[model samples]
Target: MVELLAGLSENCVRLLDVAAAGVLLSDGRGVLRLVAASSERTRLLELFQLQRDEGPCLDCFRTGTPVLVPELAATADRWPAFCAAADGVGFRSVHAVPMRLQTTVLGTLGLFGSQVGSLDRSDLDLGQALAHVASVAVVNERAAADSATVNAQLQHALTSRVVLEQAKGVIAHVGDLTVEDAFRVMRRYARDHGRRLGEVAGDVVERRLAGRDLLEHARSVDLLPEE
Candidate 1:
């Protein structure tokens, strides 16, 4: 099953105008972890995005909708840090398509373009088709192993736990807190930062620039009211 999914992902990398491609599986709380990428560079890109908690892919996964960003330069303000970093690396555009089955969202398939221009209708259609295939492959794999509901829940839980543990470690190191306290700190940080908790957690795990600096910045920014 894993082999089949890997093949599907590889095919996606070849079939699109994207310079990089990745497949992520959702853990049911709006977090997608990288399952595969077309190449090492693509995987690194996905990891960077996940750790930063910003990017079209994260947006699509959260909204269960597709995101097409044609110009990273002109729209830098929309995702200030993300745009800067992505542009620095020569990725000027991005497209993210949600991988979903019915109401169940499996994850997202993300594409990166090194130039700026909205994807034409044909490209959009192809992106959507690829996303659908990836979603189906994930669902079918789970269903074949057991009842759909059980398998789905199990997968989601396992993925979420892995992400959570990694986030806890990040928070612990950065905030100088224990694991439990780190979780609390992260929850608080997410709420105050106006971001999803799991997304923040993923960022911490990935050690993105933002997440890596979050604790020091949090200290400087005054997280609580002064006495």
Candidate 2:
């Protein structure tokens, strides 16, 4: 994932003829972290955005829109800290595009230049298109991970329920009680023993807990449900 973003940022720099570029992603705790950069200088500059909180990437990510600084020298008053830092790093201008998918803003793609100038209309459009693709890729990756977790949980629940039902069947046959009553007996035994319902049920199905023994235990403990 880091390599993918680095490649994309580098390609953006080459395509737009910029001096450097970087990608910043939210850490999901309201802090932005630099995930990729075109150069070591660009990486340091991007990391500084978090500490200073006044860089184009910060603004672009917060507003979910593009931030263009045609001339960094002219923006000292607007972003005193960021402009000073950029100047020290040999950057004359900067442009930042938000990586967004519909209403979700994932991150920002920042471009730096050695000369003061703004991107052309076409270049701005292309930059935004690339950002949008990155946003989709990130969103899809998260969704896939979430789906796998849900599937595993569902499978576990299904397996447990199957064992419980089979245990109830055995209990009903041996105790001469309804399936509902057998389930109540099993549930009570699990609760009293501080054991998981699935574990108790598995024991009954495997004959580790004999049906007749469980039936007698349920009666002695008064666990059977009323008719």
Model 2 gets an lDDT of 0.77
lDDT of each candidate versus the true structure: 0.69, 0.77
lDDT score at residue 154, model 1, on the 0-100 scale = 35
Per-prediction TM-score to the true structure, in the order listed: 0.61, 0.62
Off by over 4 Å in 1: 28-30, 141-227
Candidate 1: minimum summed lDDT over ten consecutive residues — where? 218-227
Candidate 2 residues lying further than 4 Å off, grouped into runs, are: 141-227
- Deviation in Å, model 1, residue 64 alpha carbon: 1.2
Clashes (N, CA, C under 3 Å) per candidate: 0, 0
Worst lDDT run of 10 residues, candidate 2, spans 149-158
Question: With candidate 1 superimposed using the best TM-score fit, by how many Å does residue 31's alpha carbon deviate from the native?
Answer: 2.5
lDDT string for model 2 (5-106, tens) is: 656787898888688888887644546667667766887788787787888899999999899998999988988998998999999999899986566666
Q: Which candidate is the best by lDDT?
A: 2
RMSD of candidate 1 to true structure, Å: 13.6
